[model samples]
Target: MDQAALRTLIGQLADDLGWLEQHARTQPLHVAQAAELHYAGALVRNVVGPFLEGHAALPLHVAVVGGAGAGKSTIANMLCGAVLAESNPQAGFTRHPVAYAPASGAVNWPSSLGFLGTMQRLSKPEPSSLDADVYQVRRVSEEAGQFGVLDKFLVWDCPDMTTWAATGYVPRLLEVTALADVIVFVASDERYNDEVPTQFLRLLLRSGKMVVVSLMKMREADAPAFVAHFQREVLDKMPARAVATLTVPHLTPAQVVDPCRNAPVYRVPIVNQIFVLGEPVQAARQRTVRSATSYLMSHQQHLLGVARDDLLALEGWRQRVREGQMEFDNRYRREFLTTERFRRFDEALVRLLELLELPGVGRFASLTMDVLRWPYTWTKKLFASAFARPEASSMPERQVLENGLAGWIDHLRKEAASQTGKHPLWEHVQHGFSAGLGNTIKDRFNESFRGFQLSLGDEVERTARKIYEDLEKNPLALNAIRGGKFTAEVTTILVSGGAILYSGGLALPFVAASLAMAPLSASVIQMLTEFFGSQYVDFHREQTRARQQALVAQHISTPMADWLTSWPTTGGSAYERLQSILGRFPHNLQQMEAAVQAAMM
Candidate 1:
C-alpha cells in the first residue's frame, strides 16, 4: 500500500477511536474498551505506519514496563549500562516515559510523524511527576566507550502500570510500548504475581513482542525457585513461543553501577540476553510486526465489542422509538378516528343523488323531486329545529395530533431525563428534545395536516362522482328507479314518524329524525344498486371512508409517528454519529488489518 494512503487510513481510524473514547458511556468496562480501541489505533499510526514506510529498524526500541515500584527504572538503567533514568523510591514516580538513545549515533531516532502518536517530544526535561501527555528524550553519554555496547538501540523507561496517577499517563506508556521491538518486563518479588502488571505483560506477549523478564529484588538463594514459579504462573498462559527470564538478586548500591562498564559484570546474564536478542534487529522487527498482526486478527472481535456498545445504545433508542409510535397510534385511534363522524359524507350522498338525474333533464328531475318531497322535508326540518341537541365539542384533529406528538415527546424526554446518567444515548436524547425537537415535530405535523385537509373535499367529491358516472350508463332504468325513490321517501317518513311517536321520544330527537330518514336513504341507495347492477353505493361509501382514513394517516399520524421513530437517528444526532462510527471504524480496521497482512507477507 502507498505510504500516504496508509497514513490517511490510519489517521482516520485514530480519529474514530478518539471519538468513541470521548462519547462512550462512563461505565468501567466501556472506558476500558475505549482505552483498548484507542491503543489499537495508536499502534497502527505509530508502529505499523512506520514499519510500512520502510523506515530503518536498526535502532531497535526496548521498553521497560512494570507495576508501581517494580524497579523498572533500575532495569532500564541496567540495560543502558548507565544511570539514564531516576530510580526514585516513591511508587508511581514516573508519570511519562523517558527515552535514552545510545551516544554512538549509529541509528537516528524516529521522525515526529509516526514515532509516539499525538505526544509532543519535550526539548527540555520535566519532572517525572509532571503528569502530561508528553515524552522526554535524553542521549546517554559514553563513559570510556562503555555506552557503545548497546549501540543502535533506544531504551524507554515507562511509568508504573498500577497507580491512580497511571491512568493519566497510561496512554503514553502504550504509545512507547507499541513502538518497541522488545519488552523488558521488570517485576519485583512483591509485584510479580500482581494482577495489573501481569495482565500488561500478557498483553505485551500477546502482541508478539520479544520479552525478557527480570525478576528483581529477590534473595540470591531463592532466585531459582521464584523464577520457576513466575514461569509457571505467568509465562505458561502467554502466546509467545519463547521468553527469556533472568533473576536479579537484591543488589547493593555499589552493584547498581553504570550499566555500560558494569552491566556485563553485575547483570551479565541479562546483558548477554539483550545482546543475543538485539543482534537480529531486522528479524526482531519482523517478528514484532507479525505478532502485532496476529494479535489484531485474533482479537478483532474484542475490538468490535467497543462498536457493539454504541450499537447497543442505539438499539435502546430504537426500542423507545417503537414504544412512542405505539402510543401515538393508540392515542390517534381513541382521540380522533373513533369519534370522527365525517359529516361531509352526508353531503357527498346527496350530491350523488343529484348526479343520478338524467344528464339533460338533471334540473327538471331535481325540481320535480323537490316538489314531491317538500312536505316531508318541511315537516322533518321543523321537528329538527325544535328538538336538535347541541353536540358536545371535543378537540379537533389538528389539536389531537399535536397533543399526541407532544405527549410522545414528553414521554421520551422524561425517560431520557430519568436515565441520562445510565447511558450516553439517553443523555443525548434529553438534550436534543430539550432543544426545540418537540416544536420541530409539531411544525412538521401541521404542514402535513393542512395539506391533508386541503385535499379531503376533492377526494370525497371524486368518489361520489365516480358512483354517478357508473350509474349514468343506464340512465333510462336509473331515472325510473329514481322516480320510485320519491314514493319510497314519502312512505319512509310516514312510517318512521309514526314509529318515533309510538316510541315516545325515547331516543335523542336528532338521532330519531336521522333514523326516520334511513329508509328513504336506503331506497335511493337500492336504486343505485339496481342501476349499477352491484353494490356500488356501499362500496363507494366504504372506499371514501377508507380514503379519508388513509388521508388522516398520511397527513397527520404518519408524519408525527415517523418523526418520533427517527428522531434519535436524525442528522447530527448522537445516535447518528454512533451508527456512523460503528460502521466506518470496523470497515477501516478490517482494511488496515488486511494491509498489515499484506505488508508482513
Candidate 2:
C-alpha cells in the first residue's frame, strides 16, 4: 500500500471502530469490548500510523497514568523534578491530559497530526478543567528540574482510570498514553490492585510502551512488602512484559514541598528505567508501533465481539423465516396444489388425440371409429350428467397464494414482536413487518406468480406435445393403437348388428341381445382406451401436477422465502450496516500490516 492508501485505510478502520464504540450498548460486555475497540483504533491512528509514515515520535514523552488519587500528578512532578503538576489530594482531580515541556527551551509538539484527536493542546494546564476532549502543553519552570535526567523528555500529567468520574476522560488518557514513548504507572499503595488501574497497567504493557511502575506513598517500613505484593498481584499477573517497579516512600512535608531538594531521589529509578528501556528513540517508537499493531491485529475478533449478539439474532431471525416459509409452502400445497385439476393438460390430451388421427388414407377408418365411439361417449355423458360435479373451489389460486403470504408475514411479525432479550435484529424485524413486509413480499410473489403461470402452462403444453411426439416417433405403437381401436369398433358394430338380425328385427329381442353384448364391447373399448388416449392422458396429467409444484416453488416460494429470510441483512438494515462495517476491519488490518512491513524494509 502506498502512503495515501495506507492513510485512507487507517482513517476508515479508525472511523468504523469509533462508530462501534459510540453506539455500544449498556451491557458490560459490550461496553468493555467497545472500549477495547476504541483503544485499538486510537492506537492505530495515534501511534502506528505515524510510526509507519516516518512521522517522528513525540519527543520521548512519559505519561503518568493511574487510578484516582494514585499520585499521578505527584509522579509527574517527580518525573519533571518540579512542582509543576497540581498535587490535589482530592480524587479524580485531573480531567484532561496536560503536557509539560521542558521550560529551558521552546519545545513544540505537533498538534496537526491528530495525536490528540481534536483535543485542543493548550498553552497552559487547567487544574480545574472538566473537559475531556482537550489537553494542554505547559512549560515546566527551569528551576524546578535541577536534575537533568528527564530534561529532554516531555512528561504528561494524565487523568485517572479507576473513578466513575474518569469514565468520560478515559479516552483522553489513552490518547496521551499512545503518544508517550514511556509510561510511568503511579499506583499508590491504597489502589494498586484496583480493577481499572491494574487493567490500565496491563493494557500499557500489551501496547508495548516502556513502563516504569511507581509504587508510591507507602510507609517506609511497609514499602518493601507492598512493592512485592503489588508485583505479585498486578505486574506478575500481567502478560509477559519487562516493566520496572519502584517505590516512592511516603515523603515529609518539606520533601513533598521541595521534591528537588534531595535531588528528587524518587525520580532516579523511574528516569533510569525509562532511559534504559527507551535508549534508542526510533527503536522504542517502532517497538510500540509493532506491538500496538499486533495488538489490534490479534484482537480484531474481540473488537468485533460487539456484533456477536447481532449475528446470533440474525441467524435466529433467518431460522424463523425458514419455518414460516415452510408453513407457506405447506399452505400452498394444501390450498392450491391438491385441488388443481390443471384443465390445460386435458386440452393437451385432446390435442394428442388429434395427433393420433392418421390423416389421408386413414380418414375413412377414423370416421367409422368415431361413429362406433358414439356409444361410449354417450354412456360417459349419461353417467356424468346423472351425478353432480364437485363444486368449483371457493378460492382462486392467486387468492390462496395471497392469503398464505399474508399469513407467513403475520407469523414472522408475531414471532419478532414477541421475542424478548434477543439481539436488536428482532426489534428491527418487528419494525420491518410494521413497515409493510407483507405488502413488499406480496408484490414480489405476485411478480413471480406471473412468471410461474407462464412456465406452468408452457410445461403442460410441452408434456402433452411430448406424448404425441413419442407415439409418432414409434410407428409400431401408433399402428397398434389404431388397430386396437378399429378392432373394438368393428366388434361393437358387428355384435349389435348380428343381435338385431338374429332376433328378426323385433324391438324386444334386439334390445335384450344388445344389452347382453354391452359388457363385452365396453370391456374391449376400455382396453383400447388404455392403448389410445387414457394412458398418455393420465401420465401427462400427473407430470403436469409435478411441473406445477416445481414452478410454484421455484418462482414463488423459493424466491420469496430467500428474500424474506435475508431481508434483515439488506437495504441498510442495522445488521446490514454492522456487517458492512465489520467487513472492512480484516482488510484494513491486513493492508496496514503490509504497509508497516514495507515501511520497515
User: For each candidate, what TM-score against the reference?
Assistant: 0.75, 0.83
Q: What clash pairs does model 2 have?
A: none
lDDT per residue as tens, model 2, 1-601: 5667767777788788787786575445587666676677678778777766677654777888888888888777777777778888888888888877766666644432455666776654566456658887777667766553456578788888877777788888878887777788888877778887777777778767778888888898998899788777777888756477888888888877866555357767776777776667777767777878788888788788888777777778788888887888888778877787667666766666666565678888676665545676677779889896885674698898888888888888788878855556777777776788777887888799899887766676677677778878998988787676666666776787787777776689667768557455754565466455767677777767676777778989888878877788799766676778877778888888888877777
| Per-structure clash totals for the candidates | 3, 0
Candidate No. with top TM-score: 2
User: Considering only N, C-alpha and C atoms within 3 Å, which residue pairs clash in candidate 1?
Assistant: 81-259, 81-260, 82-259
lDDT by residue for model 1 (99-155), tens: 887655645655525467668878898876778888887777776325333575678
Q: Locate the minimum summed-lDDT window of 10 residues in model 2.
A: 106-115
Candidate topping lDDT: 2
Q: What lDDT is reached at residue 185 by model 2?
A: 83
